[model samples]
Target chain A: MMTRTFLVALIGLSMGSFGWADNPNKPDDNTTPPSAETSVSPLPTITGGLVFNSTFTPGTQSYSPVVNPIVLVPLGNRFLFESEYNVNSDLTRDHGAWNPRQLNREIEYMQLDYMVNPHLTIVVGRVFTPFGIYIERYHPEWIRDLQVAPIIFGISHQQSMGAELRGAVHLNSKVDLTYTGFYAFNSTINYFTGDRGLGGRTSLFFPEKGVEAGFSYNRRLGDNRFNLYAFDGTWNMKSIPLDLRTEVFKTGMLGNGYWVEGAYRLNKHSHNSFLRKSQVVLRGEQYFTPSAADMAMTSMSGMMMGDNFLPDQNTTRGFAGWNYWVSDAVKLSFAFGRSFALGENQNIYSLGITYRFATGGSEK
Target chain B: MKSTLAIAFLTSLLMAVPAAAGNPSKTPHSHEIDGEAAYKANCTRCHIAIHTYSARSERTMISHMRVRANLTKDEADAIFQYMAGEQKPKAAPTHTAKGAAIP
Candidate 1:
């Protein structure tokens, strides 16, 4: 507790030096100096809100309490403050038709960010490890999609004593480049511990009119540490009301996988009105993973070796989903997903809702 | 009569130009997304914002999705392609001199 207090104080002191909370509205201090003009303009601001998630089972019904509350504060154009609190209860059993429960309270995310600039930012304290896209954004009540995260990337929700730095730069108005780098010193909120992994990514963009494309790579260390690479592209229709996005990714074990997603606006005139952005998404994927033993050993090696981690069998998937934006900040999604395996198949049905505060930027 | 017909044909072509220009698919452009929206909708569940911003890998991300979704190679490829295409390339990072660090 004392250590946590001291750390918070230290962060506050640093913010004060930059005149964040004390004089954020002061124009001169808030704006970047001409010599350091690469920063994202408009500086930073503080915002807060609350969100909750609940689940239901076949025979039993469950409701998660209003658990999560978040606060975000910006220091100058370089530092950001983030805190998340959760105190939800789990219902274990019932007595005489009454619900008996175990309630838990914890901090999910709390950290301080020091932006060296728009191209570089560092974070310390309890933080999240950049593992995979789904794991990084798995909260059902907070996500716009209905699917769950994959098991790779360790599947943990939080990490402590973590640090990371990431940013991007514009080569010109039509093209830009971005990168991310990170390290976690300890376990997550659930107390899982293991060796830390290193990750690097580079992406390019062409925002001239309508067509766009991007590519990226990532690597890590662990029992099953691995590498990944991908290429993606999108096109917006002119004469009709349609948009298209497609992507492909390859990994040591899964070989390569791909999907195409498109959303058409029911009403295009009002900039795809929040209520009229209702659309359908269709996706498909394929991969190969070696037998369990080979996977375990390859993961243990920590060396980047291709062809060694291929799965013994092949896995395939096909899914179609529906998504609607009730409002810009509130979204609803439903998906009927199916998986095909060794002469067998499985199916899943999912429903989800999400609400995001008005903080802006590409959190990707 | 011939001159009048040519003028009418040219006007028709001009009208088509705006229609073609308005198409996001036909044109090549960059998309500036609401970072918070992208994070909350897609990235906030398994990992939080700070973790994602730290630079996780495309392989790691795709592998996780494949395993979780039990996706086929084609399906996985499509998703990967879509995501990679959406990324905007950024400038290469430059660090300060080693001596700049505090002892």
Candidate 2:
């Protein structure tokens, strides 16, 4: 009986929304023709992509499809709500409660953003970790240069359930500065929540020069009061279609990591040619452990967590790849990578194709 | 009878907020949202199909889409800058795909 009542309410509610939606004065001006000036879409947006990944390590093998869908909703003019879920499913048979079955499955982020000012905005709820450029900016499969996430990418504070203040300032005509300061804690036993922590990033960018550099730090609270710091930068050449990006990470007194990467477009001067979309990339990374004991602890803990961001032990990794643009929205990528660690040698082969859809912005 | 059905329909439509993709004005007419990078990140998913509109016209038409696509002041600025010249104030091409792709 209660179910029937609820259904009636739902039906009534849906009918009301459609009624308002049909009002003639409600600005359903579908008659206006498309024009040249860029328009801001007030309508909510829905976008998602898929990933197929297989990895072979010394002790195990894995296969999975990474499908994540994200949404951004605006409430009124000052308040906005956004959320993303990583519905990853493991196809491997050796699936454990957390490993092949529950590996990295959860609502990645769900937050509300308030614009305090042009240079200051506040976010509340779960947010992307800002410890380094990679986690927050390039973690998306479609945006990422390589199919495989870097070993050190998810090292600390992937998400925080609290509050944050982030914005940018223009220093001058050529230089600009941006900052992100946030405090988060895991208030629930759900997936993707982090420990009690405070973290942020501050960067200086040269808009005209196409160059930027910055620093980030995090202080994880509670029993383990460890610190994580990183410095990152990017340089886009003015004369050619070549660019370089780098990031270095430091944790506690012992943990350290760094990666330097570069990409060059086969053609940049022309827009109509498909060859112009082809690009080549190369990268090198290194992570150092203070002692052998720490390396063991990292490896064991990583496996138990099902997110083994750290290698079996302290290691150095080199990567090379190719990115071909099937179109403006779809990209085909292949990567060949190698890892040098303490126990033995490791090889990684990654391939992925990402398709992105957009209605008003980010699409051309 | 027609009026009764209209009332019932409107009420139900209001309840189905999921279908409402509220169109927002870009400038002048409607109150502006900062439009931070966070908002742009979500916009990228479906912004694959690009549409061109004059800034003046866009500002005039605050789309009453029931779908909630929020924009911050920074994000709004970024979109404005993008539409103004299809360029951004600053860029990290090496790190991000630059030139014409939405931020």
Candidate 3:
């Protein structure tokens, strides 16, 4: 019932946006033809990518094929609706024959944005939680340089059903201040679940130097009352094709960790050469968890949980990977890494291919 | 101890680089803005490939990106002109009101 109500509300809002665009009070003259530089009518566009990955571990191997599709509908000059869905299947083998494929499908984010001005925008509906930069910017399969997530990826909630206010202000000619504040309501609905919380992030960006640093904070308000804090930074070299990023996060004594990654695109070679199409990436991460005895003494006792995404014990990992751009929209990648944990050491190998596509766009 | 020192060293290195490198000139004269250079500087931070859309779609997209990327009005206008192929090598002022009215 709640899901149905949310859907209806979403539809109503979208229709109202279109009506607002067509209102006669708008400033633009309707009879005048659009210039060659503009479009006569706003058109929706579809853009996303497909990824197929195979990973081999010490005694287990898994294959995953994922399709992530994004739809963008421009209601008018000020309103835009965008949504992304992730559909994937996982097939794994644990020493024996391959197991049955497990299918998973979920909506990553579905939101409507109203651009109020250059310094403020209002967003509503399900959106990526405004915590760290990784979840919002680099979690996409095609955009991420490494296939595997960092050790600290699980520290914060990935999505929230709420309203967000975000914008950027030019502090001066060289620095820009970007800020986001949001409130997410608690929901138990499948695929749309979120803990009741409020959070905000602020960053200072230097466009010419391609450098940025930010801090984030979140406080859960319900039964799981806790706070999460994070600091992230990125540097993109203007003289060379190099990028460096790092993130450190802690979640209320549950765990703490950090990851640093760097990628260098070999663009100095000839355009057609293989070396020119290749990018090299390196990453190192470490995770630390409190001992069982230490956790039992706190109010969070019995809340400790284990998952495939988060390490069960303290662990350190190092990875090296290469990506080859088959074309402007296709890429092939391979990576090898080692995980050092308390119980044992494991070697992990991954290979993947990604293709990004967009339709309803004018050819360049 | 070694890892701690390494991390500290890296953090300092990231912060210590001279901020003047590759600083674009702030000339007031109307001139041709290199759309490709502007696009590479701003858009390539997150996007791996350049996806072309209709001029109208590009306008909306750039408006959305201006807010998401915290781009300056001039920077957004420059990127829009480049992506939409509106004015190729034409002399234009930097503060033209072609895109969204951000006041």
DockQ of each: 0.03, 0.06, 0.14
Question: Least accurate stretch of 10 residues (summed lDDT) in model 3 chain A?
Answer: A27-36
Quick one: ranking by DockQ, best first? 3, 2, 1
Question: Global lDDT for candidate 2?
Answer: 0.55
Q: Candidate 2's residue-wise lDDT over A115-178, tens digit each?
A: 4433444578887767877775667777777777766774742777776656554444345556
- For model 2, the TM-score of its B chain against the native B chain is 0.35
Give every prediction's interface RMSD.
23.5, 15.1, 13.0
For model 1, residues A1-364, the per-residue Cα lDDT tens digits are 3224333433443343333222345443222222211222332322222334333333444444444555455554445566666666655333325376767776656777664322334566565444333233333344423332221222223344455444334344455444333444334335333354434333454433345455544444344555556565655454544556555666554345555655454454454344345656666666556446545665443322211232234656666777665544455666766767686566745555655443333334
Of the true interface contacts, what fraction does each candidate have?
0.03, 0.05, 0.24
Q: Indicate whether candidate 1 or candidate 2 has the larger lDDT.
A: 2
Model 3 spans > 4 angstroms off:
A1-41, A270-272, A290-308, A362-364, B1-38, B67-74, B86-103
Candidate with better DockQ, 1 vs 3 = 3
* Residue A19 error, candidate 3, Å: 22
What clash pairs does model 3 have? none
Residues A19-130, model 3: lDDT tens digits: 3232345543121223344443446767778999999998899999999988888887667888888899999998978898899888888889886543445689888788
Model 1 sits at an interface RMSD, in angstroms, of 23.5
Indicate the worst ten consecutive residues by lDDT in candidate 2 chain A: A29-38
Residue A266, candidate 2: alpha-carbon lDDT: 70
- Per candidate, the number of residue pairs that clash is 84, 58, 0
